[model samples]
Target: MSVWEKIKEKTEAGERLSSEEGVYLFREADLHQLGQLADGVRERKVGKRASYVLNRYLNYSNICVLSCQFCAFARRKREPGTFELSVSEVVDGAKQAVALGATEIHIVGGLHPSLPYEFYLEMLRGLAGLEPRPMLKVFTAIEIRHLAERVAKKPMVEVLGDLQEAGLDSLTGGGAEIFDAGVRERICRGKESAEEWLEVHRTWHGMGGRSTATMLYGHVETAEQRVDHLQKLRGLQDETGGFTGFIPFAFEPSQTRLAELGKIRRASALEELRVIAASRLILDNFDHVTAYWISTGLPLAQVALSYGADDLHGTIGEEKIFHMAGAKTPVGQTRGNLERAIREAGREPVQRNTFYEAIRS
Candidate 1:
């Protein structure tokens, strides 16, 4: 059978594809054919509803210990422009986000090498104490690891348990650049290793915490490496069933060490669709796949719906990571705009909480 036929057969059988099949789907399948197959799988899982959210990104600090090659947001601690948000500052941002109709407050920031574990807990407490509390989705596994080792001086399990008690609703998959160690060494050396990253999330999941998984692609990584990354997440999801969604983020090479390589081009629209489709086919255990509108523009995000992406991420009222890395997409978009994007994609839009629970907007 042809590659397309094989993909369709496996998808119809509700079977996950092997890494070879994932690479084949990435290379051989036409965009439209891939979207059709992906849509079939999406229908089997989520039906015709396209999920989105009215959310906000609350970046607490820019000071970082790991000066990753591809990141433009993190700043060295001694840098003149480095800043950290006080507890009141974070609460102020959450208050504004809540008032603006944001149901979820997504928090991610640089790994503060000197901050105590209590400070991190206090950040969550401050947000949770808001008069009208928004769901606090905070921290990546890397940050958790940093806290455990440097701040808390305790085991990862203990650190995670403490954070959970503090008010962490879920984890946002940020620091996972790619699971391949070779690519990791070249791009982001000082950050947690691939196994450590997974182990942190795995420990969180074992504690009954839910989180998302992401793949940062379109960098020095190979197509096979991308497939390998997905396979790793897929295997983990099968084992723990902890991942709430899978996000495939294209590497933005603009203000980092990788950018010095050349004027890196964005991932082609076709490549974005293929990655989404293949992710859906490979990550059978993951229920939601997001097309992050902040990273990929609104038009491409809309197109991704047909290519196996069922979620449009969140509002991200003021996103800094992509903007710092030279993303031209607007910082904030209204619910009406998100709904129109879903409608244009020929799917119904549904607002969802951080855990993928339907939120009536």
Candidate 2:
């Protein structure tokens, strides 16, 4: 049989795809054929039940130390429009979200140069103290490492433990932009290495914690790099079994250095679907693959359901990172809006908690 046929047989038989096979599928497989194979995988995993969480996004501060070329969200300490929320301010925003039925508060921020380590613990404590107590899904691996190495002067495991004790539910998968060293240098020069990103997550998992994985594609990376990134996440999942989901989003170049240099354009909708489908096939062990609406917009996100995505992320009220990067989608969605989109796509919409457990059908 042909290589494509062999890959198809392996995929349908519930087997993992090799890195070369994944690269082949990304580069050579027909789109429709790829979608069909990915849909089959989605079916085997979750059937027609697509999921969303009643979540709110909170970026506590935008004043970052490092200036990643692809980031439009971070501002220098004294720059105009740079803002840092005090602990009470953050608590107030999270309180409002919790009152609006938010079950999860998705929090991430730039690596502020001067925020004390206690600031994070206090933020988590305040959020965890809410009457409704939304799940405190806070911080990316980059932030965690920063807190540990620079602010706290502690080890990663110790820092993660302290945060968990303060009610951190899971780490948000933001800083794993692209694992390729060339791509990393071009985009985010002063950021953590791929191994550091993976090591942070690995340490968390070793402590019996769960987190998500993400990749920022459609930038300078080639197809092989994308597959390599996926393989790295897949390998980590195989070792830890602690990942809750995978979210691969497109690069939003507007208002960033990349766009200023005129080196790249936004990823097309077709390319977005290709990544989603390929992600489903490549990360076989992951239970959820999110078609993040903030980057793709709701229309394409809806279409992604058929292209192997089984999650629509969340309501995500008041997103800043993507918007600052020129994402034009609505800042948030109603639960009704999400259900309608899922239903319109001929799938059942299930409201879920942080861990993909169904809360409502």
Candidate 3:
């Protein structure tokens, strides 16, 4: 049978596609047809309302030790621009986000080698003590693990316990890049293993805390590897029912080690859209899929609404990661901007909190 026929049969039966099938659809199926199928799936699942969060992106520090090949955002402690924020400075950023009408504070940053776990706890305490307290979705699985194993030299339960006590609402960052070990060895060596990454989420879910998952695509990975990555996340979601959303972002290759070595290039628009569509089709257990407007431009992100993406992520007051990797999109967007984008896409704009709960529509 033809590739399209196989995809159609799976779609019609509402059956999960194998990795081979996913690869075929992503690589061979007509882009428009794949998008239509994905849109239909999206409608069946989430309906016409699209979601966005009004939040600020605050990275606490740029100083990091591991030199991931695809990263342009991390710097050694002595690098010219490398710095970490004090608790007071962090509170200042939180106050600024609140004054700008933010309801969530999205915090993620480098894994500082020597900063003690108390730093994280104190930062969370400072934010939670503010007058207009925002939801604290901070850190990634790897970050938590780092604090537990490297910095704290203890158990994650202990580290996570402190954060929970200090008012950590959820974990929100991308440490799960590509799960295939081979790809990880070359791109993000010394990072947590795939199992380690999943274990972090599993442990968090067991603790009653929720989190989001992300896949960094358009780098040195194949379609099969991408499908495998999604499959692993799908399995975790099925087992725990803890992931609130899935975000897929393209790799920005400018000024990174990957770019310097000619190992990777920017993903074409078709490739990026195809990944979004494939994710919606493959990760059946997920409730929302983010187009990640920070990586994909607003125009294409709007197009993604019809292609199975249901969330534009947030009006990130200032995003540093993508910009460092040569992203040209605005560091931040206003609520009006997100609402207008959703409305223009012919979908209702729903303002949501960190966990996909509608705050206002």
Candidate 4:
């Protein structure tokens, strides 16, 4: 059988696609064929309703010591743009987000070198203490690992336990840029290792907590490496089943250090759709694959809904990480905008919580 025939049959049979198949689909398969296969899988797994959350992205600080090359969001401790929101400030933000009908407060930030552990705990406490408290999906595993080893001098389990006690709802999936160690080092030197990232999610999964997984594409990774990242997440989800979904981020190279290298540029529209389709085809064990509208832009993001992405991510009341990295998409979108986008794509828009629980059908 032809390579395309074999993959088509495998997908039709509900069989998992191999890494070699993933590479072939990424490199040679017809884009429309891939989209059809992925859309079928999306329909079976999540039906016709595309999903999003009423959430706000809150970055508490930008003072990061890890000088990642692809990050324009982090600042050295004394840099001019460095800022840290106080507990009261975070509380006020959450209050405002809640006032706007937000059900979740998505929090992530730099690995601040000197913030006391109490700062994190109190931040969680403050968010959890708000009226009509929003679900607090805060901290990536890397940040959690930093809080454990560098800041608190404790085991990750203990650090996670403390944050859980203080009302952290789930983990974020920002740091898993690429699982290839060589690529990781080139783009982000001091970030968490693949093992550390997986272990954090595994540990959280054990505690009945949920998290998302992501990959930064079109930067310094190959097709095989992208499949490798997906396979690792798939294997772990097979073991623990804690990941709520998978998100694909298109590398925006305008302000990042890697942009100076003539080799780096924004991923082509075809490349973005291919990555979204490939992610859905390979991650048979994962339920949702997000188009992540903030990075992909609403137009292409709408196109992606039919390409196996069943989630548009969320309202993203305010997001600075991608903006600092030169994303032209706005920091937030309204429910009206989100719903209209879904309807325009000929899909029903379902409002969801952080866990993908449908709040409004």
Q: TM-score for all predictions?
A: 0.97, 0.98, 0.97, 0.98
C-alpha local distance difference test of each model: 0.86, 0.92, 0.88, 0.91
Per-residue lDDT of model 1, residues 112-229, tens digit only: 8787777889989888887677888899889888888888899999988888888888998988888899999888888888899899888989999999999998888887888888
TM-score of 2: 0.98
Instruction: Report clashes for each candidate as comma-separated counts.
Output: 0, 0, 0, 0
lDDT of 4 by residue, 1-361 (tens): 9989999899989998999998998899999989989999999998889999999888899999898898899999988899899988988998998999999999999999999999999999999998898998999888999999999999998888899889988899889999899998889997888998999999988888899999988887898999899999999999999999999998888888664533587898898999999899999999999998899999999999999999999898888999998899988999999899999999999999999989997
Candidate 3 lDDT over 16-47, as tens digits, reads 88888888877888888988999988888889
lDDT of 2: 0.92
TM-score of 3: 0.97
Instruction: Give candidate 3 regions above 4 Å deviation.
Output: 258-263
Model 2 per-residue lDDT tens digits across residues 1-361 = 9878988999989888888889987788888889888988999999999999999998899999999999999999999989999999999999999999999999999999999998999999999999988998899999999999999998889999999999998999889999999889999998999999999999999998889999998888999999999999999999999999999998887778665434678889988999999999999999999999998989999999999999999999999998998888999999999999999999999999998899999
